[model samples]
Target: MPRFAANLSMLYTELDFLDRFAAAARDGFQAVEFLFPYAFAPEELAARLHENQLQQVLFNAPPGDWDAGERGLACLPGREVEFRAGIHQALAFAQALTCSRIHVMAGVVPSNQRPEDCHSTYLENLRYAAAAAAWQGVQIMIEPINERDMPGYFLNRQAQAHALLDEIGSPHVMVQMDLYHLQVSEGDLASKIRRYLAGGRIGHIQVAGVPERHEPDVGELNYRYLFQLLDQLGYPAWIGCEYRPARGQRPHATSEGLGWLQAWL
Candidate 1:
């Protein structure tokens, strides 16, 4: 069976952030993931995880100034200091939460900078992050977001990410393959899974309804087939449920939309 982790950032929005731990656990989730953990102290977050018996499988390194429209720092030139600092901060949280993987967002390319420049910066920063994370037995992940959702984002294709991974060449670094974005950008889902998952470079997997970003069952993509494929491939990592509850603002919205997950369970 495929292991699923409730994404606290998107799921269980009806409750407080800390309280979502219990909610996920009650829903039969054995693990949890989120976008960032900088807002809360590590000790408090760890307490919730311990109480809920949920393992923290993944989270992102800080994306620069989220409210100001910055998506990430890794690919932005002259921001190397800030990007490196964010990696360390993420590692600290990972150690506290006992999380093994951290997603490092590649920022948008400014009009003034060349894409090649940004790409160089991204590769350099990831090399630094990989070295830092490897010492702690943590894996660093890079994800490709869809251009429609995030225009000007430096990374937007699986091939681009894999090519960069080849250059970086660190076992401590891997790709965070979010199927929602993959389906949106590149539609050959099953083929891509067989191609990438077999390479052992996919450190984590994520899912949401394509085009809508809702529950897996609500999407155009057939998650049942995809889940079965993951099982057949023996994907050992947790698949992060990174989608908004389809119920939309109703209490227990996440739980209500979990009928899709129950079948897999």
Candidate 2:
């Protein structure tokens, strides 16, 4: 069975941030992940994870000023100090929660800065993050968000993500394959997964419907088959459910819409 992890940031809108852990457990999710868990103290989050008997699968290393529209800081030039500091903080939380992976979001490339310049900065930061995380037995992940969803975001394609991971050349560093973004940026979903898996760089995976970004059952992608493929491929990691739980369908609706999850598990 595919190990499904509820994305608390996208789902579970009924309660406060801290309360989502219990909600996920009640809904029968084995694990949970979120955009950023840096808001609460690491100790508090750990307590909730333990109390709910839920595993903390994944979370992004602080995306700089999310409300300010900053997606991530790893690629932004002159932010090396801050990026390194964020990695340290993320690692601390991962250790506290006994989580194994943390995503390093690559922020946008400014108009004045060349893409090459920004790319170099990104690789530099990842090199540092990979070294730091390897020490703690925590893996570092880079996700390729779709251009439509996050315009000018430093990383936007699976191939690009794979190239960067290859350059980093660390077993602890891998790509976060989000199928929703993959459909938007590059098609050939199954082949891409197989290719990345062949390279042994797929650290994590996520799924949602292609255009609408809803529950996997409603979208163009055949998540049922994909889930089975992961199982067949011996993918032994959490597949994050990183989709919006349908607008206006808050609180209990989140659990109501978990039929797909129920079927997959």
Cα lDDT tens digits for candidate 2, 169-255: 788888899999999999888888777888778889998887988888887888888888788888888899998776535648678
Give the whole-model CA lDDT for all candidates, comma-separated: 0.94, 0.88
The global Cα lDDT (0 to 1) of model 1 is 0.94
Worst 10 residues of 1 by lDDT: 244-253
- Please tell me which predicted candidate would have the highest lDDT against the true structure: 1
Poorly placed runs, candidate 2 (over 4 Å): 247-249
Q: Taking the tens digit of each residue's C-alpha lDDT, what string does model 1 give over 1-265?
A: 9999999999999999999999999999999999999999999999999999999999999999999999999989999999999999999999999999999999989899988898889999999999999999999999999999999999999999999999998999899999999999988999999999988899999999987999999869999999999999999999999998888868989998999888777
- C-alpha lDDT of residue 256 in model 2: 77
